[model samples]
Target: MGLVTIEKAHVASELLVLKSKLESEGVICYLRNEYTTQIMNYLPSFEVELQVSELDLEKVREIMTRKDAE
Candidate 1:
């Protein structure tokens, strides 16, 4: 399947959790933060990215719904 963005500008932690949830549900996922690495190592980093998939779009949405309810 080709990659397609399902959500954009999502928080890093949330994105990571979302990735795990999608994986658990058997949906392949990818988080692309192509510009968030411009940070000082001694300081904090805040970044966001586009979450994606071509096959897992519906499954990703489904997991998001469940996570929102929790």
Candidate 2:
């Protein structure tokens, strides 16, 4: 019924804020972070995914894709 989004590559606190806002607006959300993967070498700049219900996708996108916030 809802949708999900890969909001951005952000640290923990920012992700938390976004999740909080979405939940306050009656949207369920899920936070997913990339686990470390290395093949004879390690890399940085991991990935983070923000997921929301399909019905709440637009609102979540709006909050996340703010130009001023960018």
Candidate 3:
């Protein structure tokens, strides 16, 4: 299955919470370059990306939207 990026965050902690939420919903989330971004914090271009299977893209977006509304 192909993966699609759902979100990008500069703070790992923020992404961790979102990752946990996605995992709890069985979306099988992935954090791309999580450690690398953390290590390269000095670089503004380096941000952690939250990704999931392309099949889960819609659901992930819905979840994020709900979370943002809260």
Candidate 4:
């Protein structure tokens, strides 16, 4: 299955927590540019991306929307 970027976080810690949340809900997560972003944090454009399966895109979005409401 293809992966789709679901969110971008400036810090790895943020994505770590989100990864845990998504995994608990049975959605596998992949982090892209996590280490690169940390190493190059001085650059404003670098961001850690939270990615999930393309099929899980809508499910992840729904979960995140509920999280935002809380």
TM-score for each of the candidates: 0.59, 0.58, 0.83, 0.82
lDDT of each: 0.64, 0.63, 0.88, 0.88
lDDT per residue (tens digit) for residues 1-70 in model 4: 8999987988878878778988999999999998898789999899988899999988899888878898
| Most accurate candidate by TM-score | 3
Residue-level lDDT tens digits of model 3 in 1-70 = 8998878988777788889999998889888988998788999898888889999988998988999999
* Model 3: colliding residue pairs: none
Number of colliding residue pairs in each model: 0, 7, 0, 0
Error of 3 at 42 (Å): 0.9
Better of 3 and 4 by TM-score: 3
Q: Please write out the lDDT profile of model 2 over residues 1-70, one tens digit for every residue.
A: 6456757554545667767877887878776663332221244566566787787777767776773387
* By lDDT: ranked, best first: 4, 3, 1, 2
lDDT score, candidate 2: 0.63
Tens digits of lDDT, candidate 1, 1-70: 6788765543456566667777788887766663453343233443455456766677777778888899
- Sequence-dependent TM-score of model 1: 0.59
Q: Hey, what RMSD does candidate 2 come out at? A: 4.7
List ranges where model 4 is wrong by over 4 Å.
Answer: none
Top candidate by lDDT: 4
Model 4 whole-model lDDT (C-alpha atoms): 0.88
Clashing pairs in 4: none
